[model samples]
Target chain A: MSAATTMVGRSIRLSRRNLDTAIMAVVLPVLMMALFVYVFGGAISSVQSYVDYVVPGIVVLCTGYGATSTAMPVADDMKKGVVDRFRSMPISGFSVLTGHVVASVARNALATFAVVLVALLMGFRPTASVGAWALAMGLLLVYVLALSWLAAGFGVIARSVESASLLGFFMLFLPYLSSAFVPVATMPPWLRAVSEHQPITPVIETVRALLTDQPVTSGRPALAWSGGLLVVAFTWATWLFRRISSR
Target chain B: MIVETEGLTKRYGTRTVLNGLDLEVAEGSVLALLGPNGAGKTTTIRVLSTLTRPDGGSARVCGFDVVRQAADVRGVISLTGQYAAVDEEQTGRENLVMIARLHRRTRPAARARASELLERFGLVDAADRRVRTYSGGMRRRLDLAMSLVARPRLLFLDEPTTGLDPVSRTTTWDAIGDLVRDGVTIFLTTQYLEEADRLADRIVVLHNGGVVADGTADALKNSVGGTRLDLTFASREEALRARSAVGGLADGPTLGLPSDGSAAHLHRVLDDLLAARIHVLRVATHRPTLDDVFTTLTAVAA
Candidate 1:
């Protein structure tokens, strides 16, 4: 009944009503995983178990793609003038952005689960106990939340819907550039250094270690990065949202 | 006054959109802010609706200061923008229900209100269909319905029927009429002269960031000019000849002369044309329309 809850519910309902968006959000990541694991898996040589190395990468990649879904609804709402409508109403100023971020994070969680399920069906063998799996999922969710907010910031800044939708494509490149399918060392030194420093690499590395029962301490950088990214993106998105709504 | 402003100013970058402007609208009445594009009609609505703050002056809605008490102002007013601000992906019913819920209606109440609005707007059959499937008129009606969920005392409509067909525009007008009868105050902006003429009790003509004319529609129309007899001829030379003989302004093949709207005035014009042997293709008396008022006022301001 509150403004925040109402906005979130409205966003979720809107997402549900758009059948194509739902399909694309859940299917695109799975399709990408299948293509890479089957078609490109044989060609990729750095990983001893390509499925093991690539599945975590795909999960993170899918989360990144989920950011596109987040960006689009924000852009669509802004373009349609619905943002102005919300501003004119006697509701919490932050409700609209809160709704979008919440809804996108929920949708991304489902998509991530679907990707993991497909990975399991593709013979991904995980030796981690339930606690480690929980931690991995938590870390993935924090990353998703952070990226979704970043996408939202981009969406608000974007002048057009095309620009907003395309902004998330930069996230998709993380998988290829990072040690998702291959070790960063195999890549050229410059690319390897760039890949090692980006946020996705550490998260993927952490998730991979968690799934394979490796020492989880290596993943600490992933948590720290995700937390920092969430803070920066959340702040930026809040400021952008206020600017857009007030304007 | 349901809405009041004084010395209100707004600027985007170096260009001033709304110069120091003053406005007042009484409760339970319709006030139309009429202007051409970029005349700051929308900017005024934005300020009054609490969507945008003014650069320099103060505005109040329902007695609440727009800046200091914006939340209170928002609680008393609603705005339907130039575009139908509905979610295309959501069905009409869903859109209405969502807004009702946001207004703090209970779940059942929200559903009931949504159904009521759908029926009222004649959108019942298409209520469950996505808004993208609805026609422009339907979407606009739904947009209006969404704004009405809270039953605010004052409603702001910005170019409410800019892109609608004649029939759709008529329907929208009738809907606005219903709101007026319900004792709800309406502040609407439009570029269409006839829309302001037919709907607004008081019309404010905005030009170059200020009110150029403010009065009843009839008063504004009458202030521009009086009745004139437009005589169309076969050629510009004949029109010029007629202009000299009849003593009026000439434009191409037509000579526009002021008329007293009396039988003798018509008779003398006919007699003069007959004696001059100047062929008159058409002769019609033109009453002052809001279009004339708008053109004259804006021309003077320019």
Candidate 2:
């Protein structure tokens, strides 16, 4: 009955309501994985036999790609003056952001699950134990959280809904050029260094390494980078959220 | 008075939005903030609602400081903004229930309240419909209903009837009147002078971020300085004769006399006219409206 509990419950309900789009987001990765594995698996160094290698990458990219739809909801809220309504309510200060972040993450999780099922159909399997799978899922969820916040920042700062979508697109494109799909050595020299050293590269490497029974190079480096990225992204997001919410 | 603010100033960079404003509203009285667009009306509402911090000055709602005691301030106040907050994607019923639940109403009570507000707002017919399907007027009514879910003691309405048709506006005005009757202290910002005249117990005129004028509606109308009596006659000669006898201004068949817009003043003129047997076909008093007060203040600032 207290205000705090009310906020959480309301936020959770809001999240559940919007999660209908979640199934749509998941459909994208599922379709792509199915087509790429069944139709084109024989050509151009097939990811089919080792589809597990690319599943994590596709899941992450798919999540980011679908985030373009997110900016509109936020931007629409702003344009229609719903943010002003939220500001005036006795709702919790952090609950709005919590609702948004959790909703986006939940959507991405559904999409990630679709890709995992597709990978399994293509004879792919995660070599890690259930415990490691849970850890990997945890990392994926955290990554989505930070990325969704970044998307939310763009939503607030963008002058228009179109511009907001552009920002979301730019986020997706940058990671594709990283070591998300292919090894760094496959790229030209300068891009290779950039791709290998990119923040998402270590994360992709850690997930890819886990799924394929690869040694993972101790994974200490990936953990440090992911942790630092989360802190910085969350800090920037919190600052943006506070500024935007107050305004 | 349950609410008072003095020397409240707010600035966005070099542009001052609210300048050293002062206000007082008696408990259970509806105080309407009247101003044109960009007149610091909404900004003032924001500051009091704890959505934005003022640059300087102090605001107290029910004896709670808005800045230092925001949490307590928030407990007593609620705002229904210029537009609706019901998500277009959500059903009208869901929207109302969500807000009620968020205000800590128990599940059964929240559902009951939501259904009550829906019926009261005349939204029961479309309660199952998504808000996007509702008309602008309906959505606005729903928004107002949602803010009332918690029964806040102090409610803020920022141009609550903007973009509504006359009928809708009148309906909204009636709803507001009912709230005042229930002992709610309402703070409203409106561009329509008629709204202020019709609903507000007191009016505050803000210009250039300061309180240019503040008083009851009658007092503010009086602030325009003089009331005019217009008398129209059948002939210009009659008008001229009336102007001469009354020592008033004449144009065509109309003669104007200055008065205080008081019935006693009208009685004196009527008695004098009857005693003199002055022939006049029509006589009407013209006092300044809040529109005039707004224009006068804005022009002075400019």
Candidate 3:
């Protein structure tokens, strides 16, 4: 294989290196969707398909939570002195980090598919055509890319595994507090204002609008916020990565 | 010379680990760096291997500047440490093949190189087993084998046998000896002075971030002082008398006299002992060991 292909292959291999951990990573979102949509579905919504409201949100949650596995393993790699070995090797520096982030996103995508399949079986339907669904997929992926970078920064900055894992857990909480579950309109006035403007709400609303074909009142705002947040996250992550690496 | 470090200085905040260290390792030869703990051995390795850049000064490996031409330096050298780096999750064969593949070896060539390294390191049988299952020695061997996958001309070994038992140490020594015999110039950092004595054509003693002394093993031992001839008599009186006659130091039943461990010194000592009629029950010569060289060199620096 070519050099770039081999590097990509190594990244893929490293990402799939752990099976149990990957499964554990996805389990939280799967279980959260199942419990909230089935158990708490009756109390919260007037919408016919509770599964539809929850899966996309839960997938976003999965992307954020699954980020921990990526962070901790990289932290573990540094802690175990595995990175010292890599530093001496002829391998590219960015390849391992790229491999790590890409592999994690791949696993997150799989979990998203699983959550989507379960939602579909429970009557979750996207009113968007194949192309729109593709575009929505593109949007979720961009979201995952943003989150992957944030976790990458966490992996670099964290001095311990627990601290690294906390970065992802901390990010997951933002989605729950945003307009992911109940609408921002139902929240207390102060939280409602923050939730409406928060980054997660826009991405979630965009995916929701794409899936349900509702009149997206905040459509222009959602596009700007989602795309802007991705750029900001990427910029911060790269800056963080460079700082940690230099040290 | 393939590798040269000119005044490589590394400081971590307030303390300097490597202080303006200058050294040169010739091509197709070995230069063993000997020092105690925290003597900046690993720091030097990190700088030369392109792991961590030095705070000051420069190092060239494989004749390429470690900073500006780091890619060229990286292209020609490999480093292994006290711990074997074979991924415990991957099999021994897989680890070697993975490294080989990383060097852009084709599938068949990678497999072939992995097998060859396994055979050379006496790890062919356990090649399929995950490295976690291997013994400490087995794992270290596999790590060394993986390093040789590219047949790097310059190899950096940092305390490569620190935790190994005697048998394992000997096994690693033999492997290193084989590599040296193959004309691979090895730049090794070791705590074992004896290891340096055995393997290094020239040994440089590092202490407090700089060279304390650098010479061949025997040359270093010679620089410390002449050998001492210690003789023990049954009584303090005889020891005293022998001490006066030979101009030796008498403490208890022992007499310590300097000798060059040559026939002329022995003959002169024997004549004096006979002249004094001192009945010496036991006689022994204390040649300066590598330990003596280490202690003296580091002690003076300290």
Candidate 4:
């Protein structure tokens, strides 16, 4: 087996051993989607049925939650000397971080699917065709890639796992500040402007339009943001990995 | 030489950790880099292992320049840092297998290698237990075992037995000895004098970011001081009497006198004690320890 495959397998096994991570990645996102659609669904004014309106947002939210999942394990590995051990070995340098990223993407993708299942059970349905579904999935994956590598960067610089987790907490609330729960137009002008420009807004808006078969003026900007974020975060993460590992 | 460093220097900001250091290690021999804390033992190891970059000078391991040919250097050497560096969440068997697989071994080959290492390190019984449950010694053994997965020609061990118990230290020593017997060149660092004395074919004393002394353990010890015999008496007065009669240094119930550490010297010392009618409780010959050499050399450098 190749170094990347071996490291990914090892990372997955290591991350699976943490019960808190399992709850955070899989259970908490599904629960949040259910609560939002059931308890808070009727209060929203702009959307006719909040279940259909909020499922895409929840999918984006759960996928973003993978930031913490990626960060915590990487930080733990750093503290535990496993990263140092990997550095001294005669293997591909990218394998260690790549392993954590691939595992995080796999795990968050599963959680995103679970949220979709729960949303479907709550009377939410997508009007888009199979190709649109595939595109939506691709967009969610791009978000995962951007966030996971960014979180891995945070983990690399963090002195402890708690610090890395704290660094990732802002990503969870990003969807809240944007169009995840309520329409940006419903907010005041300033808040709406801020919400529309944020990364999550473009992503949620694009995914929402695709699933609902609505016109997507935001798709180009969303693709640009995701692609750009992936590049910047991947470079930042690789730079940090190189600097620290060489020490 | 399997490893050589020429004026190898590393600095952390304004502080110099390794300053114009030079070292050489022959193949298939155990070379111990002996030093106290903050003496740059670990920095030297890191440079040689390609884990850290040198600010100045150059290092080569297994004939590959550590900076320009790092991948080649890494391909031929394995380093076990001061910490065990094993994954605590994984079982010993799993850790070994993970490393073996990373080294590009086949699945079955990795498994076979892991089992062999587990048995050789006497970790077979605890192979399935998570490393978190293993004792420090067990974790260290597993760490050493993991480093040997690819059977690199040279091994770098930084303070391998720093926190182990006596029995565990001995076991680790035996394990290292076994590796050397198999013709693996070992470069280990330690603050323990006895560790260097017992395992090192040649000891390099690193002090103040430079090599203060380097030679065989016996040569370093002899360079510090000669042998001396300590005669213990039943009473202080008797020891003093024997000291004056034998022309030796006296302190309470013990008299210390220089000797060649030969049987004849011992017999003559006993003969002097008998002539003086001093009752000797015990007699011990003291050869200068690595501690003595280290302290003296570092003191002189200071």
Candidate 5:
């Protein structure tokens, strides 16, 4: 609908103007990748090449950062009283959330591209065919979409911007406990169970396998987790938005 | 009636905000909901604007129910909240155009409406500037202008001029006056008695989430006892003597009696005091204001 398009345009403009956050979303992940490749790569001998093994993890981390950034703007809108203005109009709550979610996906695309570019400069290489690369990016897109909606839900529940930024903390920290940095089997039994059972580890493993020409053992589970999260998160976010905005 | 509400109520937890209130507003009239803090003025506006639902009773705007036909109510109304709701990062023009577009205006049409409003509100110079750099008054004006982008039949303004400087307040008043000339039905809430006195054709004094007084400004003022003469004597004994001689309510050293505000009435009172050999220290006439009505009503309700 036209209302959704207008809201999307407005949200993108807001994202563009927020230069500090935009820069942080892109630059932080690239710096993290560099740190992992140069400083931590020598100590980890489980992978044939740490750079090749870690790039997929870094990609997922970058999207997590970008997607969680959606919460700040959503919280800002609610605090600013603009959401009341929109709700009083003929505009539906779906259009407003669509705007933020779409903008989050766009921001993730840019951040993901930047992380991949930096990985190549640091001696990282992917052995994937064109179809495999497309599939990997598609899965990353789905994962970002899911996380962004979940962040938007947090935004609606947050009473202030500071509380909303807590989503970023969780997103940034969850990947570290997953298989993104080290193999799940190398961890203690309890830690290994957590890393293998959580959603992020499977997504990172699937992307890593696809890019490295390895056996794709986690593909089905990755799709299942991402798809299930996308459904629950999208439903929760839109429902919360309507409830909060209306009364 | 363009808007009608009967026994409308809302409660947050155990504290009721709107308590079985009833109201009606004819088309093209300015109605001011006058009340102090915690009087539920904002809650009432929120319900009428379709942003909130009442707990017990029903409300209709433009012949559509506020709860069941909320989308239809939204089509005919706009709300400007106590806080300025403009986007700080977007330019003023962009803010206006975005709202216009949300109302289904074409891009060119939205732009034209935005420009026209910017010119009307004297925001042409800063139209393209980001709202972050705008002064408080400029932002308020832009907020009001955005609500007018769709030209709704009814507008709800909750404390529209609450925090503006004097000049900005007057400018906003002028803008609102212009809207009235265009036959727009306005329902505004204000803690400023002067604002309601200056703008409202019908003033409704709300207390404890219900209407305590509703009438024209002059009518409510009159209800709180009209002009009266205050006679202050040198001592409490002289005031008591004057009260017994002239028959007025005595409090300490002063005696207050209802008057028709005539020179002859003052002369007669002075002569009556003189005949009784009571010396009057000061003579002053007090006229009732909307403040008096508000205080009297709320105090009684409390």
Candidate 6:
């Protein structure tokens, strides 16, 4: 437990020092939200107000960007031989992976908060009660945690930092295909199926419903997907860490 | 023994890195695993330090099995790999404190230990600077300082001075010498014969993943035939003629003859070469060093 806390502190410090990535995590999603609500929102006729609709998607997209950034640092530690140093000590691989995952969750929280603040300044309003807001944030936390662990697993397997950044590209692209920026009904039949059936779509829909104080239809699937992904990703990351570090 | 390995073997996709190797190191001694690239020096250190597992046989460190009791092994050992493992984003003090904390030191205690190590390694000036701003030698010193934060009973250094400049190398050597004085068991690997001779009480020559020679530096050197006279000739033909006339070993343009380090023996060899009409360009008596032992042992094994 001490080792885990120490690693977490170290990882947070690393994240703080990495100014470029931190800025990108917060700024990119805000810019994307502005682009969607002002530029693309006028053409879409399915939603009443695009800012309120696009804000939830931007929140999910922010988490995706933040979670995928976890992979690069994890890959750096692995390639730089620090993981070997840690493994040779009494430290467990669980602690090391936990450090990165927790830091990822923290970064996502901050970026999500920034995106929400920008949405409010741009004429977006959420009509949720306090409890609903808490529940929505809690679900977003689970999603971020799951994706971060998944990224850490990729980091362990990636041979270099450049390859690890590819995970970020995939995560950033997933939100566009989901219900983040546009309504699923507005898409082609095949893309609509993809947007409705994928994990990100359900997560975004759940958050949107909770914030808008509307009927929550996707809550169960959102929790199920996030919970299932958390289990698999945590198991996979720790297993890969143990195997690679020991070898 | 602080470290004991019997017939240890490791194969990487059919290429054996450690092939039926055997080794032992007594407590409070410096043992250097001397070998060239692909001789498995790093593998041996990795196996003993619990970073790697051997395929066959077994290894025991500080009375715990390397595979089964790996956690215990880790508890008593620290490894400094070929590369400096310090985090570039963190400051030097932070890196050291992190390691100390991982070793279960209290917050204040970890801080104190980090300060002490930074001062000892002459890194106090750069203690709060990020490792990314450090020079090569400073980073290496910080890497060593981090490894010593826990003060383990045993330390494994795999090519500790491989890429350092000459001054940094000597400073590292001095730091290692200080550790030896503190009675820590050190198992270091190096390709430089001088490093093995200077810091190791016992030098083990590894070839083809096996121990080819293991003894004190002097013992290994004596094993390669001691106190030879190096007779350099102006031409390879003259060296060959001197070798045939005086019954010595011919290498390039030099003939090496075993000598007793006496004036009479030198005179006799020069007389024999002179009578044989072999023109000698240089005459120097060479003492056997670890280089001779390493080359001779590895050459024979090859």
Q: What is the C-alpha RMSD of each candidate to the true structure, in Å?
A: 3.5, 6.4, 6.1, 5.6, 4.9, 3.6
Task: Please tell me which predicted candidate would have the highest lDDT against the true structure.
Answer: 5
How many residue pairs clash in model 5?
Answer: 0
Any runs in candidate 2 off by more than 4 Å, and if so which? A1-24, A38-41, A46-50, A66-72, B225-285
Q: What is the DockQ of each candidate?
A: 0.73, 0.38, 0.31, 0.57, 0.72, 0.72
Worst 10 residues of 3 chain B by lDDT: B81-90
Give candidate 4's iRMS in Å, 1 decimal: 1.1
CAPRI docking class of candidate 3: acceptable
User: Which ranges in model 1 have alpha carbons more than 4 Å from their true place?
Assistant: A45-48, B233-280
**Candidate 5 regions off by >4 Å?**
B228-283
lDDT of 4 by residue, B24-118 (tens): 99999999999889999999998898889999998989889999999999899998988888887889999999999998889999999999999
| lDDT, residue A129, model 3 | 73
Candidate with more favorable, higher DockQ: 1 or 2 = 1
Please report, in order, the local distance difference test score of every candidate based on alpha carbons.
Answer: 0.87, 0.75, 0.79, 0.88, 0.91, 0.89
Q: Tell me which of candidates 3 and 4 scores higher on lDDT.
A: 4
Q: How do the candidates score on chain B by TM-score?
A: 0.87, 0.81, 0.83, 0.83, 0.84, 0.87
TM-score of 6: 0.92
lDDT of 1 at B113: 96
Q: Ten-residue segment with the worst summed lDDT in candidate 1 chain A?
A: A44-53
What TM-score number comes out for model 3? 0.86
Question: Cα deviation in Å at residue A38, candidate 3?
Answer: 1.9
Report the lDDT tens digits of candidate 1 across residue range B38-144: 99999999999988878999999989999999999989999899899998888999998888888888999999999999998899999989898999899899999
Ten residues in sequence with the least summed lDDT for candidate 4 chain A: A40-49
Proportion of native contacts found in each model? 0.82, 0.61, 0.40, 0.75, 0.93, 0.93
Superposed by TM-score, candidate 5 places the C-alpha of residue A246 at a distance from the truth, in angstroms, of 2.4
Order of quality (lDDT): 5, 6, 4, 1, 3, 2
Inter-residue clash pairs, candidate 2? B18-B209, B19-B209
